[model samples]
Target: MQIVILNDAAAVAAYGANIFATQLQKKPTSVLGLATGSTPVALYQELIAKNKAGEISFSQATTFNLDEYLGLTGDHPQSYRHFMNEQLFSHIDINKDNTFVPPGDALNPITACKEYEDKIVAAGGVDVQLLGIGRNGHIGFNEPSSGLRSRTRVKTLTKATVDDNARFFAADEYQPQLSITMGIGTILEAKKVVLLATGENKADAVRAMIEGPLMAACPASALQLHQDAVIVIDKAAASKLADLEFYQHIEAENQKLQAHLATL
Candidate 1:
């Protein structure tokens, strides 16, 4: 994993936006895997700025969100669909037809999950996936104990995740017990993955993901297996990582080595 420790949340977001912009430059019609939460808000804002400057365009890009509360209406204030619209879609030029959020209130959830995967396949699969690690290490809504090879499916939110997400809902009663999320296998298929974390609240999870054993207890640890995953975190979130200075030195040395190789 390539870990970048930025000075603060805004810097982390700027770095993530630059990564996304770089990918868009390579593939203008790229399919993007998106996540919703406090962590990605600033990144979305930076993308909006790029859109406004005409430095990047989303008109041809397609997006698929990571997860959504199973019983909530798309219009519900607390729904992931609502979150995406307010934070991203409203500010960008992406076509409404190319944006997809899993059907939260689908009566036939199994079929819905299958169809969602089919849609992604039809769209050429995601070129880059953005992720946020939950305090308990869940990715999307696939909480702990989720099989590594799981596909798009309905998941029962763990108490920790429910509590973590409760802040968005007006009341505890409004929180959904279930959610629809793309599985670990689906995420692993992405050509590139960028995971971001910003606050002290995420420090432990971030540390576990990069350093601890690749156990199912922390689902984000699965990224250790991805060849093209990069993790961008603010200093606060990287606090628990051991030998952080060593990693920094290694990155610097590698850059110097690359420059020397280019000259030769």
Candidate 2:
């Protein structure tokens, strides 16, 4: 796991955006694993601008989202599919047909989960998977105690998660208490993973993810076992990490090494 501490959320988004921009430039047909939520909003905006400027293009890209509310249809206002269309697909040149979000309205969720897994394998797997951590250190909807080697499936949302997401729904709106999400093992399969977090509210979770043990108790900590996982956060979000200075120093040295290699 690599930790990158930025000055603020905007910087974190810009840094994460650069990673995506570079990936798209290197492989225009890259299969990307995307995430939803406020954290990724800024990053998506950055990508939108880059696409507009012709710095990157999603014309040939295929995307898979992390999860979707179990009972919501694609056209539902609160569904992840709708969120993706509004935030990204509509703004880019990417073919909407190539984008995949777990089928929230599937009659047999069990079969649908298997099909979702199969689709990912057929797409050559994800080149880069983007993520956003919850305040409780959950990734996707795999709340606490999720199996470390689980796959795409339906999962019950924890009370904390439901409460956190309550704000998105109207007072009388029906909020889904379940979701279909990519499992920890499924996420670890991606060639590279980039997780972004910001704000002091995420500080403790960020610390547990980067500095905690590799246990299912903190699902985000599962990233510690991934071969290539990058954790990008603002200083505020990184406040609780024990080795903040060390992480910063390591990034600095890495930058210097890359610079030297560029000259060589």
| TM-scores for the candidates | 0.96, 0.99
Residue 197 in model 1: lDDT: 98
**Tens-digit per-residue lDDT, 128-246, candidate 1:** 99999999998998788888888999999999988887777776366789999999989989989999998999999998889989878888988999999999999899899897998
lDDT of 1 at 104: 98
Candidate 2 Cα misplacement greater than 4 A, ranges: none
Tens digit per residue, CA lDDT, model 2, 1-264:
888999999999999999999999999999999999999999999999999999999999999999999999999999999999999999999999999999999999999999999999999999999999999989999999999999999999999999999999999999999999999999999999999999999999999998888889899999998989999999999998899999999999989999999999
Residue 105 lDDT in candidate 2: 99
Worst ten in a row by lDDT for model 2:
208-217
Model 1 weakest 10-residue run by lDDT: 165-174
Return the TM-score for candidate 1, rounded to 2 decimals.
Answer: 0.96
